[model samples]
Target: MNPRPTPSPFSPIAIGPLTLKNRFIKSATNEGMSAQGVPSKQLVKLHSALVAGGTAMTTVAYCAVSSDGRTLPNQLTFTQSSLPHFKALTDGVHQAGGLASAQITHGGCFTFIRERSTKRPLSASGGFNKIGLMSGMFLKQAMTEADMQQVVREFAQGARLARQAGFDAVEIHMGHGYLLSQFISPMYNKRRDQYGGSLENRLRFPRQVLRAVLDAVGKDMAVICKYSVTEGVRAGNSAEDGAQIARMLEEEGAHLLVLSAGMNAESITTMFGSSFPKENRVQQKNKIIALAMAIQRRKEPTVEFRELYLLEHARKVRAAVKMPLAYLGGAKSLASIEKIMAEGFDLVAMGRVLLAENDYVNKLESGASRDSICTACNRCVAMMYTPGGTSCVLGQPGDAVLNSQQAASR
Candidate 1:
């Protein structure tokens, strides 16, 4: 008998009850296209373009579980009034012959917008909130027993809303220093309670949240969990801790796991690439904040961009867990995607490349291109703050402001 054949990048794969037509998935990236916390036409058009371009599934990034969980006022927060907007977005994706995933998350203490009910953001442990300093939010409050219970319910409800919105899947945001990540990382979680200390303890709240989400939507939709293999900071969880967390998530009933790295507040470049954006338009609004950000930027470690940068870390987790895994970060070329599939990753999740070339997957399958045009300059990162949200600068018109922004970055 012949040995089982290895799956190719274009092969179909299953994640719980859902089977993607291909292994290519659009990794969640904040589009900044929401209209006052509701999905805008731009957001719908963005995913529909990717679906037309041949992505098997596209993820809507950062749908806050609750209003207070939002990082920005424009970010999507699931509410009854916003349901129709989300449904329209998902309906467009479906019409384009693609599956849509909602990345449910909470901003934790990293929020720029404070809720009316609670002026302060909540996290596992209360301390200085560096990410919110520019917004004048200097401190975060620790979550009480009631707060944790409420958040758990919020996550479960968020999943239910995703299903109601016609999303094929719900990717729980368990990484990138979000609320759940705060519970998982020692750097953010300094609590002395059952949800802190050891790895198991730190994982307790995240586990509970995951379990709740699973119970809410596991049978109907694919449940994916995105986690950092490392927090990319000295005081945070390491790659080993990430593997352990993966096991716990699998045990908690996640259908798929996306391995990512870095913390949004500290080591964002580790996840998005080392090329820091040159434009500081957002920071320039306040001279003091600009100076502070400059200092913070200098303190962040420089992680150079390379093909398959996260593969080495992902391989460790792959060997440790038997469940399906999606490899994210620096997967640009056909060679890189093929290499990832060969190494046992069930899916290849691309963010920057998709932004640079929406039809990249189709191009790869048709042998039209082997590599992406994205230089990984990370200019798109700065664009997330713009009214238009995140977009590849390469495809933008040669307008004077864009030209100047590009030149200034150089």
Candidate 2:
């Protein structure tokens, strides 16, 4: 007898040599649940739940390639010292029947420079983010001829370590406001050097990272890339700018492309969230904090994110190449995800939605009649990216899994 075919978004996807059980991707989010960059029992417990829920694969957030590349101390950096820990993480996720992937990064200028004092991070430009108000050159290293060569070697070395750790795939981090992204964006990379100036020159570093990662991981391991179309879409960047980046990334042999726009956290307008900082509230005493947030948000005038169809953006990229694609930035509903897949998007990358509901995929598969698992309060974003998890609107007391993970991770 023939077996029944799977549903639209629930269908298996061909990504390199492996096939995912579903087209649902648990997009990378800094789930501060690792113990000293090791797979804490907390993350193990969390990923177990996500895989049981049926996500195609779960990316283990940002695994920094260099210590100076870190944005947060809590980030999982994949190093030789952390191999035993990474081994456990992959084992746990695979046990639950999902492909386990790690995104290796060098945070560059956008890296919160306070994290390291050893070596300065590589960057296309030597500027600081408007969000961070410390006022120093974030890219202290600023990539010399020697620096670029070292970085190319670093990414490949990182990939070698990831393979040893048992990760089924390794995503070369070239998106968001990270080091590679700075190289990809002209607004950030303002130099007359060989690695800067024109688009091809600007793309050199990221392309090198991709080529190296693929060579290191080889034909079997799925090599994915997470890249935003435009670096500062919220800070006056355009869709066309993002589309251009997608084309460039595809040319560099990206097997997968992820598009994320706008800021992950915000200086909240209204407040269901406590960290959302009652927008207009400022005593003379607290004025400094408010002023900082205001400055971060100031250049973001008309930063509108009105229900963007992220897959449509991926479709734009797909139009240029035959690579598999995934879309992130809040795919909240099964119906929406299914629609995207039916229209040829390979996967729907979800971050906050998965954080809110660990059983989300299970709910979708089991025909569970439950309300939407996402709060849309953007609370997880507020929590993970915030100064503290103290202000999560999703932090509904004892039951929220993230808070539990935080407790154990500590």
- TM for candidate 1 is 0.92
- Clash list (residue pairs), candidate 1: none
The C-alpha RMSD in Å for every predicted model, in order, reads 5.2, 5.5
Per-residue lDDT tens digits for candidate 2, residues 347-383, read 7887767777767887887888334555555435435
Error of 1 at 198 (Å): 0.7
Q: Write the per-residue lDDT of candidate 1 for residues 141-234, one digit (tens) a residue.
A: 8999899999999999999999999999999998988899999988889999898899999999988888998899899999999999988778
RMSD (Cα, Å) of model 2 = 5.5
Sum up the clashes in candidate 2: 1
TM-score of each prediction: 0.92, 0.82
